[model samples]
Target: MMREILSFCALTALLLTGCTMAPPYSRPEAPIPQDWPSGPAYKDAFSKPDAALAVEVQWRKFFNDHRLQTVIAMALKNNRDLRVAALNVEKARALYRVQRAELFPTLETGISAKKERVKISGTQGMVNLEEYSINLGISSWEIDFFGRIRSLKKRALEEYLASEQGRRSAEILLISEVANAYLTLAADRENLKLARSTLETQQAAYNLIRRRFEVGFAPELDLRQVQTRVDTARVDVARYTELTAQDENALHLLAGSPIPADLLPRELSLVKPLPDVSPGTSSEVLLRRPDILQAEHVLKAANANIGAARAAFFPRISLTSAIGTASGDLSGLFETGSFVWSYAPRIVLPIFDARTRPALEATQVARKIALAQYERSIQIAFRETADALASRGTLGDRMAAQQSLVDATARTYQLSNARYEKGIDIYLNVLDAQRSLYAAQQGLIAIRLAKLVNQVRLYEVLGGGGDASTSPEGL
Candidate 1:
């Protein structure tokens, strides 16, 4: 019956203590819009609002290039930013460990011996005396009460978790960047090839015109017109070649290796294709994005910090105790009588702190600021996901139109050349047709590049790419 009464008292203390402190935290009432902005919603833009996504079907799985996969894998392990992010995780964890240790008692042990000689005439006689003293014991230790120590430990652990999330966010970005860069290089190579092919066509036309002039069938003016077209096309090809080289170099730098001359294929002219991107609704993707997760962790840490700050306003209760033995001789240091120990539970009432109120207020304000930042992160993620979905739709339509235009221009240019050769149209008509085709070709490139680039942007918007080292999971 007595033991049952004791258990009831213990349960009562736990319940009462829990009630005295702030309750478990709930997130703020911030806006989480359920739907995306209207206009150009893809055929299957999203199935549901922002919900957490599975990690397996990441952006890397979107691309089929083996070369790209290899590069991304290597970057994760070697990228400098990823390495630094890893270090940050370690630092936060260590800080949490230190703070956690503070909640428990600290015990230290030491032994000391002292000798003193006293000589004085005031002692009634000249006396030389020697004394040896030794002691060993704990001096001070702290006991936590009033929730201060517990709150501090809790805050530290939350902060550690936040740092871990932050590292994952960095990893996500790194992989995304590498994917975009490689794809850009691929598209640029295709543009360069197109430029070369166009130049070759102009050169053939010029050769035919020059031969007609030699046979006295074409005038100098007609030959010069053909020459002008050839020159312009040649210049364009040269510029694109240089641009492609620069892109290659930049890609190598990001990849952290010497890009093989064949690092990428000579041409990447894919038959028009776009991925079937299912832009999951706002609610579905926003929370899964690494940055948003990191921000939430930060919010938790901030809430814990407020609890710690509030605990500081109350009296601190601590217990300090020590048990040790000391003796005048080295052999007796550990003996039973050569020991001294102390224990105390101190209550330090905060009667005043010229600096405490201001500090406490500052902490409270800082926590509020952190909360705002966390909410903003959520809002930003929501908008990005929506924007990407909308772009994919518009870009797809634009790409289809551009492909038709290129096909039509190519056929028209060929017809004009045939008519000029048969004397049905003037040479100037052929020149005009060729110029139109060249511009149409370039326009097609711009549209195609846009499609690929926007897809990359969409990936980033969803926090989908980058090497694992820089990704949230890798962190």
Candidate 2:
């Protein structure tokens, strides 16, 4: 009958402990436009929004260069920053588990032995006592009568989720950075090649003019002008060489290890542009961006904290109970008559503490701060997507114009060279034409690189090339 009564009381206590003081959660509305920007700047880029394009495009599919793909993979595997972000996620998960464990009793078992002697005066009597016991016990486990433990557990879970989203954000940023660095290195190499070829051409021209002057066929002025052009081209060669080396160093740093020479692009002239990405109209896609999602998680955690603070106004209840056996003789510890048990229930009421009210106020303020941060994240995402789209709209037109300029300049240079050979024009005209052609060619390369880089930026701001449901590594 006694055992049955004890079981009934335990069940009642469990049933009464499930209420929570937390307020209902609703996601804050985004503070940006529902649709992407419209007008001349965005018309060509977002002409028809493919709502599913961003979700479907993966980084590998977007970047077709085998070399570039390999470098990105290496960075993902070896970058120190990304490794730290992944570790942070694991740390937050373990902390959540620790907070969650408070909801359940922790059972512990131990053996104890003691010996004591007492001496009395007068008639003289001395007694020695030995005691031995073994027990299993629960120590000071919170019963959570007012939902304090439950609220804290919910807060911890939200924080863990926030850390996971943070890791995803770091991964996305790293992928974008690696792609940008790779593209920069390729552009620098192409520039270096152009500069070296121009220097050789100028040197050949200078030698021809010097021979003409020596043989009385060309004047000293013509030889001097050609020599100046040669000197300028030499300077360009040196500058470009330095830039290429520096670019390689930057790329190596991003990769976090030395990249094999064969894995780098000898030239990016044949590389294809990244595919276009569509930003959906509902601004719902922004929700999938890891940074925005992380902000929301932090806001949710703050909300849970408010609940915990509110619960502090009520009494906190905890339970400490044990059921085991005790005996004077170690061999008899497990005997039926040696059974022993204890149940302790404690409650703490906050009567006059000065800190409780202020603590609650602090949580309230933190929740407001979180809400503001969440809204700001949405605003920044909208602006970045708009900027990328604007750049995409006009880059194609700019590249076309630059190609025409290069063609026209090349024809002018060829005509001027023929005139100089036939003695119809001075060598100064030939020098001017050559310089114009070289500048146009270099400009064309810059425009092409810009077009390609903008595509990558578009992919990044549109929440990366992969689905938000999975990470770059599919972790």
Q: Which candidate has the top score in lDDT?
A: 2
lDDT values for all models: 0.68, 0.83
Worst-scoring 10-residue span by lDDT in model 1: 466-475
* Model 1 lDDT per residue over 321-405, tens place: 5566646556766666665655565878887777777766776787778888888988887777677777666776677888888
| Residue 46 in model 1: lDDT | 52
* Per-prediction CA RMSD (Å): 4.9, 2.9
Tell me model 1's lDDT, rounded to 2 decimals. Answer: 0.68
| Tens digits of per-residue lDDT for model 2, 243-277 | 87888887788788999999877766856557667
Q: TM-score of predicted model 2?
A: 0.93
> Which regions of candidate 1 fall more than 4 Å away from where they truly are?
1-24, 40-56, 119-139, 270-277, 281-284, 465-475
